[model samples]
Target chain A: MSRIKAVDILAGGFVVLIGVLAIVESTSFDMGTSRRIGPGYFPFYVGVLMVLLGLVIAVENLWTRTASDFGWSLPPMRSPFLILAAVAAFAVMIERFGMFPSIFVAVFLGSLADTNTSIWQKLTISVAVPAVCVAIFKYGLSLNVDVIRWRP
Target chain B: MSDFASNLALGFSVAFSWQAMWYCFVGVTLGTFIGVLPGIGALAAIALLLPLTFGMEPAHALIMLAGIYYGSNYGGSTASILLNLPGTPSSAVTCIEGYPMSQQGRAGVALFMTAIASFIGSICGMLIMAIFSPPIAALAFSFSAPEFFSLMVLGMVAASTLASGSPIKGLAMIGLGLILGMVGRDLYSGLLRFSYGVDQLYEGLPLVAVALGIFGLPEVIKNAGQITGRTVEARSISFASMWPTRDDWRRSWGAMFRGTGLGSFFGALPGTGGLLASFMSYATERRVAKDPSRFGKGAIEGIAGPEAANNAAVQTAFIPTLTLGIPGDIVMAIMLGALTIHGIQPGVSVINNHPDLFWGLLVSFLFGNLMLLILNIPLIGLWVRILAIPYWVLYPFIIAFICIGVYSVSNSVVDLYVLMFFGVLGILMNILRFEPAPLVLGLILGPMLEENLRRSLTLYRGSYTVFLTRPISALFIGIAVLILAWTIYGMFRARARRRAALAAGGE
Candidate 1:
């Protein structure tokens, strides 16, 4: 099966499963005053609607001419690898550099795939955006953080 | 004359403080940056800065936050039009016509036109706010719980109109979102609904984490492996100057007017707010266009109308929020936090109490729009250059930034675990062709909805009919029912057509 169809089936199945579970689980509770719909009442209906909708989606995809948009193509993986690395680095160094430096550094080095960027421009951006962000957010606003300690 | 003069002078006095001006500049700049980058939204930007804004004076902090909110709305079209990637949910309307324009190599014209259109929209919305805020606030104050619930239902039904792929899929996604929203603690009894005994799901999902995971990470994953080399056979179109031609002005002015009209109405509609404004604008533009076929094929009207509507909606939505103390949307919800932190009660009393805040905010909006126009028009070329950055280098940083931003929100490692878990769920959501925006909207509004629904029941002596008996509530519910009926009919017809086609094929 195509990925789109595959996912549709799985999602449909999951929705159905959730609906069944909600129905089964909700039955144990006292549905309580008819004047006020119990907590389970809204959820039970929502679950039923989900299952019905999922079935419709699944059956429709099976019978209908749905477009296959999710094509599988593995382009160069360098960017993905780098992106993961940058995320890891940021997650680790956030406390050290603070939100400003951490974000600027991640966005800067993370944008390194462009052949158009000069060393000077990169250096300027790398230095400038973080500093500006720090000045504006931390010092100017008096936001408390220990990343770049300033004594005036 | 004396009152007008005093208010104007006082507004300028409050808005012109050096610190306020600097924050405005910072807010506009940050707004532009986020707008240029796909998947980073104004709401996320505002939420991240909420903590930082805690220290500044209420007016200055809110001015900056509000600037970022609308500034990003203005700039979001740059990437969508030029790069075929929407920078925010609101800008997806641009992508229908914008990506095609880029493919035709009129990316520059599209970018320029959108920027101009945004400025016009911002100016118009501000004018509206300046002239009519008190009346609008007075109207908004009349809404009660039943009316609010009806409004929320209207928003939920309208989720299908969010410029999405399939109507059934869209509605189904909304259902899914509502279910996901119900996964946390039950508001009335304090009992868990769908927690499955996991402590992480106790307080429900955070809006930022869910937004980042569902919308942000999926796009990154999709784009991570795709090559972005532009191969435009069509010659690129450039304006002789920054100024739009008289014809451009004529075409766009109508769109701006129409957008403002739609924006004002949709922005006031409690739950969806600016989201519906952008969608409604695009749909209206499509319906009204002389050549309807040109939409989704590089129509400048497509860009102009929706961009205008989105920004206008952002500004006008504040009227209801600021005056009523009820949030019009999630961004306003975060701004509510800012208000409470600054010790300001956002209600009828705000105008009675702090005239500086009310007038200053109004005037700062005018100043902020001017600053945004000056800031974005010249920076179009610089923004386009951002697309030149390679995926390998950019993707990791985006992922890392998402991680850090989510983690920093509460200084809780538990939130990180919650984020990662939802990140997986988000990827699955994408795979299932579900639009995540409504889901995020649901999660944000769920708590409020529960609280109000219960309060209304209590008020009515446990009578459910109270919702329908109230005039405003009845009207809103009536509209919601009509919308739902229309959607159901539409879905049935589409499904029947598919079945007919299948039978005709002798299957």
Candidate 2:
């Protein structure tokens, strides 16, 4: 027996979830006559079509037999986890803490993902990156953000 | 011909202006900068730099962005030759011959020939774009709502089908994109569709944020620690060694022209771009070579042909994008988003309404290619040195820029969250083998597609038959149907063959 491809199953299920959400949400909007397409008309049809497409993807994965098919495997979570945390840190801190602090922390977090670098190297990078960025984005380009502020 | 001359005169007038020329220079320089860096691509660079153009003139903005797009093609081959790494996807073909050529100590010759080929190809492609675009736009003027809807359908179907993944998944991504496009408030009724209680999304997902989130962040995440300091060792590429022999010139000139011809054709076609064009040119060169055995083992024609083809394709890819408002790939899709940010509706009217922007951009290609030729030859060492920059140091700056870039798009912190959300989504989609290019194309085209669909329905009094009844529209639909059927048929046939092989193995 062939092992099921988890990638296709997950992709199909994820798509189905999105389709159902679209269909469910679109039902709230007006479904007018075809002559005058309501907001939902385009989306509602798109949703139904998506649902069918999702099902096809899921079913096709089970029927097809091929070792050449791109097998699903978990990506190296270290980089993704650290990098995402960095972006999240930036998002959460950018408003409340301000630009410099937000960027410093984010860069610090992002820099930690590199095992090749030492703590001293990471800290220097975290500091230098934000300084150069402030010069470029903040000073050079005049990006409208405070270098430091206490919003909270 | 008079119209062509006068239009070109107008183009020169706009492009020669010092400020416009300055933006163009900066653009190509930066484009080459990131293009030489192994892991970072033109797409991510464009996204990262896109926000900086917000304060500029629309014409200059487009000129800069366009410069980045083509300049990267020139820079991409450097890494391919020196290292086995490709700076851009289209330049991957270069590595096959380029790395071998470098190994054989003919790296300088390969580099020089590629620059010369790229320059010729770009010039020819630009000329073709200049000559062909007006007529194409003129043809597009006759296209109405049904025709537009059909064309968009054709474009979406064609783009997804041709994209690197399962056609169904591509279609599904497009569907997701369409839903994302419907997030903003409805134009007619003013009803919000999928804002999902987040009031910030009423203006639609910020294009810059969405683009940067999808293309920019994932690339950084994937490459941050993974590809560490790649240094160019003691071998320095001096200008003295770059000159080619008489035989080299004779072999390469024909290959360059042939590659340009193939690239211009493939590039102008919807959904396809430089990657496909360059590969085609490589195959053509191999087929037409006197001794095909020379191909994989440091063939001058290999580098010359593909480099020419990719650069030529880069120039012609703008033809469909600027004329049809339907971008062919992820890069073009970002470019289309750039125009939308500047309040320019890309279509047939773009040429008629914004002649200066269109013509000036076309003219800038000449200057940009010239800039690339200079950068590639005399300044080749600078780029080689650039390869030595450590990834750990580079990626933090990249992450910082991404965050600030997304934030500065509208000064909304909410956009930051949006960026984070899509960054994760991008990673997830990457795992599922979903090609983000189709999704992006679908997202950008979604609103226009919906608008055209509604208008066609209204104009034909709710008659869906109008799509088929109209000749041009019907033709487009027919093409879309044919492509979809062909793709599905191909998939089934492959599956059947796989089954047969499995049965044989069992026996």
Question: What DockQ do you compute for every candidate structure?
Answer: 0.24, 0.79
Give a tens-digit lDDT track for model 2, residues B283-363: 999999999999899888998998888888888888888888877566888898888888898877788899999999999
Off by over 4 Å in 1: A1-6, A17-152, B1-14, B89-111, B130-133, B160-204, B225-240, B270-302, B319-359, B379-381, B384-387, B499-507
Docking class of 1: acceptable
Q: What is the TM-score (0 to 1) of candidate 2?
A: 0.97
Give per-residue CA lDDT, model 1, range B1-507, as digits (tens).
Answer: 577678778889998888888888888878887777765677767755665565688888888898888888877887777667777778888898888877776676677778777877777777776666666556656877777676666666665543355555666666666666777777666677777777667777665566665656556655653644543233333344446657767777788778877877676555456667888888998898888987777777888888888887787777656765556666776676568658996655565477788788878887888888776676666666665565544554455546655665566545555555565676666656666656665665555565567667767877889889999888878887887687667667766887888799999
Which ten residues in a row are the worst by lDDT in model 1 chain B? B230-239
Query: Each model's TM-score?
Result: 0.77, 0.97
Specify the highest-lDDT model's number.
Answer: 2
Residue B273 displacement in candidate 1 (angstroms):
5.9
RMSD of 1: 6.0
- Maximum-TM-score candidate: 2
lDDT tens digits, residue span A1-152, model 2: 23346778888898998999999988998889999989889989999988999988887776564666755567899888888899899888887888889999999999888889999999898889888988887888887788888987
